[model samples]
Target: MEKITHISVELRDWIVNTMKTGASPEAIANAMIKKGFDPIFAYRTLLKLVNNTPVEVLAREQQPYIYEIPEIGQKGNIIATSDRDIKVLMRVEKPFILYLENLLSEEECDELIALSKNRLKPSRVVDTATGEIKTVPGRTSSGTYYRLSETPLVATIEKRIEELTNFPIENGEGLQVLHYKVGEEYKPHFDYYPASKINENTGGQRIATVLIYLNDVPQGGETIFPKAGVSITPKKGAAAFFHYGNSKGQVDRMSLHSSIPVLKGEKWVATKWLRQSEILERS
Candidate 1:
């Protein structure tokens, strides 16, 4: 939102020419800095131009056909293929189903909704490109979230983990729900360690993630991993499970994902993150 300084018609033409020659924004910014321009000014100017340009113009300026995750599964019930079986869906391989169809009853859904009415709050929204911070605006799209550590839902979700993975479940800092209304979507990103500034190694390296869809959207609202070629739609009461850490504590890189924009209706999901250690170091 802050305006960039040092951006002029000449600088704009230089940037456009450089881009025509296949220079990335980073490369262009560095080149300008070396030529006595402020690096931040160059970077910010580029961002402003990109943001202000029409989508069609920007598309012409960048790569054509950016890869996207395709919609694969639907709401209700379906089995998921493991990484070994599918090879494309990366991380831990196993067949699993969306839990929304059978995990919780309508009454239970109502209960969870009632509980969320007061507890759900805005989630931290980060602009990965600019390092800007803002609270997500509303319950629509990638906005509001309820931290699971403070909710009864955590216990229920852990029991399901035990039944499915046969691994003892331990409580941690808890999960967060990302609710999306029509037209809302989360961009591609990785779910790993939050920066030190946020939690100071508190999450102890996320090991796995379980996302349970609480409400069904008539269409769209899929969890997508473009690199993995996987997309799963939102279903009432169903969950998606994926592992991110190895037995030796190395983080798996394949867990990067995104949420496809909701085209119609609404979506609500409950997320559970498994940690390598207890949330609290001291009892």
Candidate 2:
């Protein structure tokens, strides 16, 4: 008997029906082979059809990211909240980053580190395809998240950020503390996500970040913006704040940044990710 290589319409429909009736691929291939179909072709076709991978659509062309000055940019060198005073150490315009000092205090920094020291776990990223949190090689650090305003210290910091940026505290995600030992680094990446990942319930698309340095690094662990030729050193109680997204849904690709490998000492930092609107609890 001659072996069939190409699948006909009738045969394809039969195969689909057989699979839907709870037949396994191995059993289907055996049946196809008994009917004089090419063994290799039978197995391969069944496998492909079983997986049925979806095709990805091409993204439409987008306009350049429009630059919108953030509230922190308009303020004077000193930003005074009801409880604290933060100083603007430096400002970078191309990507819109602010070097802030005294966002936390010496005592606050130490306390945060101590609180998170034992609770640290390997850092993770949101899986683009599956929408799951997962660990990846690019980010090599241990970190933990604190519930929004969970502690007096956390509440104080959140209040300060709310007053400083004029964005409501409800717009911010839980505070995160990260620890990078020597040689650990977070590879360069954007903070903004693809539109599909933004969930309105957990606030909308992230618009900005307030990454506060909880402790000074003796050497490396600098926040690097490669495109802008900028490197911000980690200082105790200081921070690097960058805004990328705007109301029009435009995002600044120039806000790309990373944590360079800690060449000398351990690095500790607290991070707050801000969204476009108040975060609603998942129902």
Instruction: Residues 112-170, candidate 2: write the lDDT tens digits.
Output: 89889999999987643234466767788999999987898899889988999988999
Pairs clashing within candidate 1: 82-94, 83-93, 99-237, 99-238, 99-239, 100-236, 100-237, 100-238, 141-180, 141-181
| Ten-residue region with minimum lDDT total, candidate 2 | 53-62
Q: Per-prediction TM-score, please?
A: 0.57, 0.78
lDDT tens digits, residue span 1-283, model 1: 3433454332354344334323466765665565566767767766765566611123233322222211222211242332111112222232222222355555655667666656555556443232345443221344344444355665665555444443445534454656676777665555555322224345466666677678878998888766566778766765676665555534444455767778888777766666666555412
Estimate candidate 1's RMSD in Å.
11.1
Q: Which regions of candidate 2 are displaced past 4 Å?
A: 1-60
* Per-residue error (Å), model 2, residue 208: 0.3
Error of 2 at 265 (Å): 1.2
lDDT to native, each model? 0.52, 0.82
